[model samples]
Target: MDKSPDAYWKATLRLIGTVLVIWFAVSYLAGIVFAPALNSIHLGGYPLGFWFAQQGSIYVFVALIFWYAKKMDDIDREFDVHED
Candidate 1:
């Protein structure tokens, strides 16, 4: 089935929004707001929260970038808008 341009755009925007929200939650909420609680857990001799703040968020961000790209590629294919 084919989707209209408007529908394709809306789907793209929704995907972007969802990815941003996940990024924010990991970067802000986990790294800062819930850091204290997360600190109670240990990861490789360092506090889990500290790890999230110092490295995990960056890792998640990079992973998210790849994930987003792959998802968008799939979306483009679904919408019949993929590049050659």
Candidate 2:
């Protein structure tokens, strides 16, 4: 059975929202609010915030986008939805 355009969009938005929330929370918690505690463990040439701000968070963001895309694709397949 074919799915409606609205269903595909809804699934995409839901994936975006879920991934964004997790990304924001992890980045904020590790980079700022818990920086001091996290600093106790060293990473490369920088402290926790420096590492997160400069490198770690960026890597995570990329992975998050890829993960979201894969997850959303699975969701679409489950619902018989497609962008085209």
Candidate 3:
């Protein structure tokens, strides 16, 4: 079935919002709010909080982008709206 433009836009916006929420939660909240507790654990020469603040969140964001692209690609195919 072909989806309306509005449906596609809404789905895209929702996907963006969801990823942003998780991005902020892990990068800022987890790195700061739970820092003390997380500091007890070490990861790759850094504390967990430091890892999340620096590398982990960045990695997760990159992964999220690729995941979102793949997911939307599938969605577009499902809606028979994918561009070549």
Tens digits of lDDT, candidate 1, 1-84? 549998999999999999989998999999999999999999999999999999999999999999999999999999988998
- Candidate 2 runs further than 4 Å off: 1-14
RMSD of each: 1.0, 3.2, 2.0
Which ranges of candidate 1 are over 4 A from the true structure?
Answer: none
Per-residue lDDT of model 3, residues 4-73, tens digit only: 8887788878888888898888888877888778989998878998888877888898999899999889
For model 2, residues 1-84, the per-residue Cα lDDT tens digits are 436787777777888889978888668987778777877777885787668866798899998978987898798777866475
TM-score leaderboard ranking: 1, 3, 2
TM-score of model number 2? 0.72
TM-score of 3: 0.79
**Highest lDDT, which number?**
1
Ranking by lDDT: 1, 3, 2
- Candidate 3 global Cα RMSD: 2.0
The 10-residue segment with the lowest total lDDT in model 2: 1-10
